[model samples]
Target: MATSGPVLLVSQAQQRKSRTYTPSPWGDFFLHHVPCTPSQLLSMKERAKVKEQQVRQIIHETIASSDLLHVFEKFRDESGAIVSGDDASCLLMLHDAAHARTHGEEILDGIVAWSKSRLQSLVVQKNLLEPELAEEVRCALETPRFRRVKRVEARRYIPVYEKKSTRDETILEFAKLDYNISQAIYCDELKELTIMVELHFWMLGVIHDPYCSRIMIVKIFVFISLFDDLMDNYSTTEESNVFTAAMERWDEQMAQQLPAGLKALLVRIFNATNKIEEELKLQGNMHAELIKKMVINSAKFYHAEVKWRDEHFVPTSLEEHLQKSIPTSACMQMANLALVSLGNVTTREDVEWVFTFPKIIRGACIVGRIANDIVSHEREQASSDHVASTVQTCMKQYNVTIKEANEKLRAVIEEAWMDIVQDSLEQERPRALLDIAINVARVADFMYKREDAYTLSFVIKDIIASMYIYSV
Candidate 1:
């Protein structure tokens, strides 16, 4: 019998080597299949144009290390809460390759190593039949040289947008306003849910013409929904987690559309989530109202999508998924639902923007949790339940098995936030809208520094930077 370990690594490596020149399986999978309108594509270009300018100005300005320190050191009324939110968002957002460049080069190397390790783990778990493909993924993920060039491009991309339109000025101002609004929003647990509401409408706002491309717009919506579900609970409990709600809302529609094999896969996923929910007895009390509203609206969105597909309606440039979900009767005054419903409206109504604010804040919360989990995933497994015992579980997880991966992630988060801040400042960019994201990265760095789990290397700083993204 052949040894599985070496055989797996060699196969994965070869695949990675072969696939480097072509589009990645994951990339191709996402690009063609994901739904979005033409208007959404135009919106993405607009956002990207604006984002590019913000990034460029940051690169050109003589930003002092002291300015960076000052921003990090500043205190707010809800300093603790702000810090927590900031750390989580940064972790979630900057887990990409491009932003990993601000730190020294080793962090990129570490990502490659981690990808390789993931391939190895997949083999051990029997999740990979084609080890060569796994190796290919590892190779693609390992491209430090590529990442470096991308970073330069990203930096250059921001400045070119400075000349675009007056909309840039207005957006920059709005971002600054979000700083105060975000802090206020986060202070009240009820108000925090507003984050989701705004993001959804942001999706809606991109509907320019029927023929406009809406890939970026739709991507944001889908991402927010998936992320919201992931953050709420990975389990499939009926008590009402994000996953359970979405499943309930979209199950039939998705099921009818899917082929038999895919439908079976969906059923299994649903069953698994439900089982997890049962095992955990996951409390819906914390996010009950928010879950209810999200479920109702999500169901509505799915309902409309199904109708359009069933009728074979002329593909409207903008889908009317938004039209079906609104005017929920769920009372927000009830504390349980109030907190949940705080930031979850589906309209672009004046009050709706506040509702979506919490998604970003909540995203930060979840990202922080994810980072902590990265530190502790292994140890938690040995426990009777795979529950985390410490706040710094991610740090702990990094220390024991994948120290370098954790370091790389942290560095990326830090650099990403700094770059965003620089862009916001230099281009009059919308820094405030991304407050939660920036704060998440900042607090993560602070936490890591205090924990001293790993060496304070340049690579670690880079991961932390990549965590910051501009929502402006």
Candidate 2:
């Protein structure tokens, strides 16, 4: 196949200076410069260049060719291992092909399966390879680029590509510069958002990964944080009701008669949702329309809580409290957004399953709602106007002490988690989908385990700095 990109060249001076020697614990290793003919050195350099060129050709062919089977046939030798001799490059191609949206007619499926098996075998025997090559193999095996954390992958890949003589210097330089630029953008977005409403963007590193899916999830959480703040601190019962109705209508006319802050928030939500829908469409997800309904339902649930607070009506029963609070938790909406982030792996059936409010989804939301109540009820009670949390409702209905109510709520949280575990085992749920729901509960636990970490900026500053500010 004809390659489109310009060929890269490595200078002899640069190649000569690239060798390194490390002394062994045994002693003075004059072995570092074991006598070699100048011709031998030149031959080694040429062989390295040939291997690099082959690897780059494989990458280019995989990317440029529409017929994956033809590309696979050309790249693989009789034994079926990719002919590149660069395992990392082959692994990258396998990942890209596996993730391609070809519906059920995946031409690269056999290649992916073969590549995975071959890679696993190489990883097991990695001790036989050079230190750098061994590490590369280990990293690829540990987390394929498709699944690797985005920021970590950038940090890891830049040096690998830099060492490849066949890689265009301009491309390597661009990757380095892009990493710095992306980090700056993430920091700026997080800093402004943290000030407005406390949240830890630990997942920001995901921006470097596939389709910007991780950052999209972060964006959804940012909006969730802002919406929570507006509901908890700013809007009155009447104002919140009006805003909720407008959200349900989801039209420009609904923005009329709203306060400036609520109006601005509505616009942001609309724009964000529109952007998310566009991304979903590009990924070929047919259920993109469901995302808007999920968000609207979340808003309506928020309004229900506001109504209860406004009427000074605590639920008379635990069931009533759960029924009201679970949807309002917004975990389901977040879970659905998480599904959307999976791109081609998520089917319309997956979206429909989520909409059904299965055991796992319900369990996760219940855990989140009750966990928040457990940690934040005291602070929330200090506020003159506050919706009754699960803790308060349990305390009032059972005529129990605060400690007892908390204990009961904790048990409920435990039961909900069991429900998740049971559903995961029985239904053969998609691991990715299950993971998102599990993460929703995990985030809830992290935010509310000791206190409302999401509401308290200082509590998670160290975490933010370590994940985003400090390099790995």
Candidate 3:
């Protein structure tokens, strides 16, 4: 449907009415609530590391003598044996066992199968349980803690743990402190990101990690976000074309060709890329050149979307759209950032493996692209001169209604998730990169669950507060 000339005869800036985003609900609230100073946080981290080593050594000694099969049986007995008497503990065990069975580690598969069977029985008899316990049972059966990542489960479980008669004060206090500290770190990251007009975005994925290295990654996330905003929403086609060429060359002199706004944008882009390169190098990452290459490649992908918009191009089909869309989803770049952000533990092999854009990462990128497009299609089109969204391309290729196209795309999202789960269970890659890929996918599902939560920040105001603003 596009041509050499833009289909929209109107000036893009004239037609591109900006969306008014609200100030974050917890503005400046976190800056006031940081319980510990920077030095204290560092001390706490060091102490936590020491304690973790002690715990790991103890676990190693225990595992050497203990049979995991026998340990799993204890779960079977605890949950299955007294299901009528202890609703909460029994429900939790059955839930754990059921999900564990579905993922089904070979050694524990038998016990997990038994737990699913037992859990089904409890579900059938939920009528006799306390109302609250029945709800808990339903949630466990449906969403299950195993399906949730650590942070999500932690938020859900902390309250549940506190309700127990035997809840330990030390553990409870520790959980409170840990969550708040993580929240504080998130606030600090957000403050830096705000300078770039971003985040509460990246921290959705990096919520658990508080190291300074992650701030650099967050910077990249912000820069890319602003870069997209500039090209897709604000800049003229000619300006975007010029700026993209400058980026491709990565030459400072090219900035002279841009208008004032784009000139500053190009300078910031170079400065940010250089800083990331510098930081990665300082950590002894030998793959700095590759990282820079990825940054440029990602920018090129972003510009492809802009060019599509500029030409008013609808992709010939979904396949053509995805060729660029998947990479532009930011999954690959974030996965690369995740590798280096973890510090010196990243081996050359790890960097090489991630750079390959392995199967799991592709699946994750699919989910990130499609899931986001499904939720964000309207907002993006309205706020910017958006090219054909995933939905549009699907509709055009399949000749389907918007609802039907969305349904097909939603199926694609599930397929992508299946790929992620299957690949993760294989354990063929570095655990950290795989986990980060999964988290990137998780963030997509969450941030776009019912709305474009990132742009429509109010949708997740309570969530942001819970994760970063409020105490446990």
Q: Tens digits of per-residue lDDT for model 3 on 1-472?
A: 6663465445544644354566666555554556557887777676666555655666688789986565544443443542233455564665565443323344344544454556567667837666656666766665455445466557767887788787765566566666656766776766655433226444456335655346777776766666667767667776777788888898889889776877997898788789878877887767666666766776787888876876778897887888878877877777777776776566768776766677778887887789788998876667445777899899889999889999999877756766777788785667776788887777766667788777777887766556655566
Native-structure RMSD, model 3: 5.9
Model 3 scores worst on lDDT over the 10 consecutive residues at: 76-85
State residue 218's C-alpha deviation in candidate 1, in Å: 27
Query: In model 2, where do residues sit more than 4 Å from their true spots?
Result: 1-212
TM-score of each: 0.24, 0.58, 0.77
Residue-pair clashes per prediction, in order, are 80, 0, 0
In terms of lDDT, the poorest run of 10 residues in model 1 is 326-335
Candidate order, TM-score descending:
3, 2, 1
Choose 1 or 2, whichever is better by lDDT. 2
How much is the lDDT of residue 238 in candidate 2? 56
Q: What is the lDDT for 291 in model 2?
A: 71
- Write model 1 residue lDDT over 242-326, tens digit each, in one string: 3334465645445554435435644555554444334323433233223334444443443333333223332221112112211
In order, the Cα lDDT scores of the candidates are: 0.33, 0.63, 0.68
| Better lDDT candidate (1, 3) | 3
Please, what are the lDDT tens digits per residue for candidate 2 over residues 73-152? Answer: 67667876545454555665664445322224234555555666766676667365666666766665544444343454
CA RMSD of each candidate after superposition: 24.2, 21.4, 5.9
Best by TM-score: 3
Where is model 3 more than 4 Å wrong at Cα? Answer: 1-19, 26-33, 37-149, 165-174, 188-201, 382-384, 397-399
